[model samples]
Target: MISSISTNQIKYVLALEKTGSFSEAADLCFVTQSTLSIMIKKLENQCNLILFDRKSKPITLTKEGEELINQLKLIYQEFEVLQEIIQGTNQEFYGNLRIGIIPTLAPFLLPLFLNKLVTNYPNINFSIDEITTQEITKRIKTRELDIGILSLPIEDQELIQTSLFNESFLIYDASGTFSRNKKYKIKDIDVSRLWLLEESHCLSSQIEKICLLKKMDTSKHNLEFKSGSILSLLELVNMNKGLTLLPKLATLQKNLIKPSYIFNLVNPIPAREIGIITHPNFSKKRLLDILEIEIKKSVKPLLDKTKRIQLINPY
Candidate 1:
């Protein structure tokens, strides 16, 4: 009976599970609400179990239904893998590649290689999202995302990580508080006048660690502000006479911020290791190789080749 279930039926069920609404799921699956409902009911009848609680307002799966959906997702992923395998055998890269990048890296990093990738691989379909580190790892593990580009080292042992490049951190002092001619050490930073992204961002945490923000006294400032965007952070810094740490890539856009406002860190410069992460069983090696090559080529010339560097952990 299980063998009799069609791929379309599986897709219907998965879509319903994801959207938690018959109408929304129907739209996602490109089917009528009635058709989706009938297919799911049929699937449930065949198994002699009620998969969804129809009485529930947005619809919810039962305990047994949850277990069944878990297995169904695995089966669906395997089907995708089989398709990828066939495409790989043809020696042609033509398939969907779902990519998630952390917000801190997404803005600065995507601009470096996205256009080249899209132009070079016209056959590949790229779906990219700016997601947090935790969400990226979760989606990759669930086979929802093909790859993640973010700062390492992630604690997940199930994922395979490939180091892409080391991006150094620089001080963006809009108030001209720090000397432009000299490299500033972490100890020279005044936490009271420092602004940062909200604590949720990994970049914010990395900055905190590098500057020892937790240990410093920030109570002197009457107004406390934190932003989710580097661009916003820069704006606030400029308006309020505050400073924030920015990744090297963020400072490269000369039109966005003046060269006089950007300052370098002292010797043994703090940097973050950016990398691509994927599940252990991820296929499409050729696609990954090309992506890595293009990204490295784009950023190699932009990044400083100096040997004095210290890698900051994102965790």
Candidate 2:
């Protein structure tokens, strides 16, 4: 009969790898260093491998140990997948949901239903991180995050994306060169006078594609300020007497960015399809469904794409 490895032992190995210290790893596992050391020794005996270099200060994993740790990560993730599948089938929503949200959407979207999720699913815990699209995409792939709320149709084959809602972009023009309630075309954008979020933001890429904004001659617009936040972008536009594309949800009354300054795109009304992204291995269907539902319920009435709206592919 094959000797069964303890899950706790696997967890200890992972903790030790993460902290690179016996005592710290033991503290993380809520055990004494000697206890954790015994567990590691037992695991080594069972697996017939030397897992760590205890002689090294702040212990290092041996070459064989590195290989085993990689295997252990895969095994642990698969074990977690099994647990999630069972919990999903049992309708038990009692695990931590590590979620990553892109900055452009986080401010507007999270306020709509985050509180509701906490209130409704009291058993579920949340570890919400405000991250950039690139960061979240990488995190989702590594299983660091359970879900990612980001702009959809990511080209990654490893991620399974679920359509949430279509968010229409509104042009915020402080100079009023474009008429209010008028439909503007992408070609109509004065790239020199346009204010955009920084390169790190996915929305910046989307806007760049939608507006066909390339390298502009700085002589027309003096300073170059690539803002990281939508709010910051708005301020830059206001101060520079420029224009920017903003999502409908972001232009809410509370934001104080004036509805009269907002304009819809015509000819091909450009919008982005926002969705919930997850790793293919992720199996928290119950938690995923609830979060998706809550977001849709809150934002649907405000951003009903059933009306005339054209979508632009940012990818």
Residue pairs in collision within model 1: none
lDDT of 1 at 88: 70
- Runs of candidate 2 exceeding 4 Å displacement: 1-91, 214-220, 306-308
User: What RMSD does each model have against the real structure?
Assistant: 18.7, 18.3
lDDT of 1 by residue, 48-87 (tens): 8889987887889988798799889998999999988876
TM, every model? 0.69, 0.68
lDDT of 2 at 55: 87
Error of 1 at 224 (Å): 4.9
- How close to the true structure is residue 54 of candidate 2, measured as C-alpha lDDT? 87
